[model samples]
Target: MTSTLVENHFRIGKLPHIWCPGCGHGIIMRSIAVAIDELGYDKNDVCVVSGIGCSSRAPGYMDFNTLHTLHGRALAYATGVKMANPDLKVIVITGDGDCAAIGGNHLIHASRRNIDITTVVFNNNIYGMTGGQYSPTTPTGEKGTTAPFGNIDRNFDLCNLAKGAGATYVARSTAYHANMVKQQVKAALENKGFSFVEAVSICPTYYGRKNKKGDAVSMMEYLKNSTVNVKAADKLPKEKLEGKFLVGEFYKSEEPEYTEEYKKIIDSFQKER
Candidate 1:
């Protein structure tokens, strides 16, 4: 693939990223950059926000107004930024643990309010940063440092969570599908209200070794083969979808953006006065 499109967008001095060799986070980050490029968004008009985790490190390389916030607090910071300056194109880069666990309440409310910010959750299913702990999206029976015996806890379907919570756009893609990731992210960016894209990523160093899922290549291939498009999944029998997940845009709707609604309220108050 050509680097021309994303080359200028990144800080070349930060060339060697801290992510593990073969980690999918890098691919996801590149996909986001590609989406931004395709959408013709001016770098100055974009703000990238992230929470603590491996996935959150993306903002360090991207040459944009970036915020590295507290763990699971990316949404809160992004919310504040967008509310204060609705003209900025706010995009959030978060991890499964950061978005679905401690930051989950923020995720729900952000979607509930239909805030004008696009979120991309790197769903690696395990916390690769602070140690290889199983996160909320960890598949049942998956092994991690904290779940050496295999996790029995139910996993959260992030896309469904966002859609159900009222996000105007919701989609899912995997790192293996780089082009699809870019497309989904671009679509999310174009949504007026809250938009979410879940990028299923691979953590080869920790999650892979702990679970014996083979190398990063194998894990990526698993994501490619194990997931069906949402349309195809609908036609499949329940038994066929037992071990497979669905990808592609699952939901979308028109809604009043939170910032826009807030502005209307302020305007009404001024008129009343």
Candidate 2:
């Protein structure tokens, strides 16, 4: 029953994803599947590592090798996995909270090291797994259960964070732009260093209802209308740019992957010895 979608990539008896209706995580998951299938990597050679969150549930349904790690530990575990077996293609799927809040150090360091791994941040802007608490990526001035009046803390611009932390490939996409998301994820996978894909997802159950976003459909519409391509985005006049957001491949560059670079240093020292 393998469709052209992921003939080699799809797992056995893992159909019917269980995410809530209108949850953007499912869309991101499909895009990932498509991207991996396009990469032509065998399912056995790929592993999906995830931390505790709604997004983390993704690995469970995937047919390929998967690891459901502790809260905020996806990066650490994935780092170990890559270090132990450099032949494996590891992908980390984590929510905004899991990746940006408690696991922030791991996320930053992994990018700095430029390990041969791909990180996909399902940035739904709030903690969807738990009862909607404010998250590091939640928009400022938005009301949450904790921030009844309004959120005062500024949110981390995830794309900027990844780029600043030295990730070799950084991209932003959304459920609205499903095809674009696939393209960016594929690009990241093809790259040979720390690759990142920040797919802004929709959380109607938490973020939408709390912010009076109407419903899942409305929130999705918002995501669609909010984004602009990076190139055209920069060209937008200042006044027109207000209240709008960009979602596209932001930056990409080739750099020495940490593992390969370390091997080079070791080889050099061995020659001297």
The residue-by-residue lDDT of candidate 1 on 1-273, one tens digit each, is 337766778987787799999899999999999999989999999999999999999999999999999999999999999989999999999999999999999999999999999999998989999899999998899898999999999999899899999999999999999999999999999889899999999999998999889999999889988999998987888999988888998999998889999999999999998
lDDT of each: 0.93, 0.89
- What TM-score does each of the candidates earn? 0.97, 0.94
Worst 10 residues of 2 by lDDT: 6-15
lDDT of 1 at 259: 94
Residue pairs in candidate 1 whose N, alpha carbon or C atoms collide under 3 angstroms: none
Cα RMSD of all models vs. native, in order, equals 1.5, 1.8
Candidate 2 off by > 4 Å: 1-15, 266-273
Q: Quantify how close model 1 is to the true structure by its C-alpha RMSD in Å.
A: 1.5
Q: Which stretches of model 1 miss by more than 4 angstroms?
A: none
